[model samples]
Target: MPPDSDSPLPTDAELQILRVLWSRGPSTVRDVLEALDGDQGYTTVLKHLQIMFDKGLATRDESGRAHVYAPATGEADTQRRLVEDLRDRAFGGSPETLVMRAISSEDVTEEELSKIRALLEEADGEKDDASSA
Candidate 1:
């Protein structure tokens, strides 16, 4: 399903589950538990899965003894929505402001800078093509 523009982002617990589902596809509660931090309990994992299902963030297949839960939203869509939300809330909805924050905030190593420069170059190329067209 498409990420709801105004829909709230997943809670940290939900995000943790989603990262697993996103990377591994539909997963059982057991699978999620194994992948998650050892500090969390088995019941805690099941409880979070149930809550996520109720919240429309997940779907379960009950054909098997152990149900498999999958994310309803695409990972990219969710990430975009979240980054956009942060951009709006923390950076006044400006990509430049968001980039500035990322650049100025903690230790941005040369590797990160190189990647950012490449992305900027690609964006510039896209803009030039659009304008020229």
Candidate 2:
């Protein structure tokens, strides 16, 4: 399903589960648990799955003994929501501020910087194309 822009951002724990589902597709509770490798027990994972289902962040298939879970939204869509939320709340809706703050950290790798540059160039090209059209 297309992501609902109105949906609230996923909590940290919820993001963890979403990440697994995004990467691995539909999975059982056992699958998520093994992927997490955290101290959280099976019951905790089950509870989170239930909460996610209720929140519409995930869909469940219960045709068999084990219910299969999958993300209701695409990874890119969710990431966009998360970034937009943060930009509005923390950067006064300034994309430049967000990007500057993000790159200010020394932990950002050279490869990451290259990717950012490439994305910026691509966006610029798109703008130029649009302006001339």
The Cα error of candidate 2 at residue 76, in Å, is 0.9
Q: What lDDT does each candidate get?
A: 0.87, 0.92
Q: Write the per-residue lDDT of candidate 1 for residues 11-114, one digit (tens) a residue.
A: 98899889999988999998998888675888998998888887777888999999999998988888888898899999888998898989986799989999
Q: Which ten residues in a row have the lowest lDDT in candidate 1?
A: 1-10
| Alpha-carbon RMSD, candidate 2 | 1.4
Please give each candidate's TM-score.
0.89, 0.93
Query: Each candidate: RMSD to true structure?
Result: 1.7, 1.4
Candidate with the greatest TM-score versus the true structure: 2
Candidate 2, 3-115: lDDT as tens digits: 48776678999999999999999999999999999657999999999988888899999999999999999889899999999999999999999999999899999999999
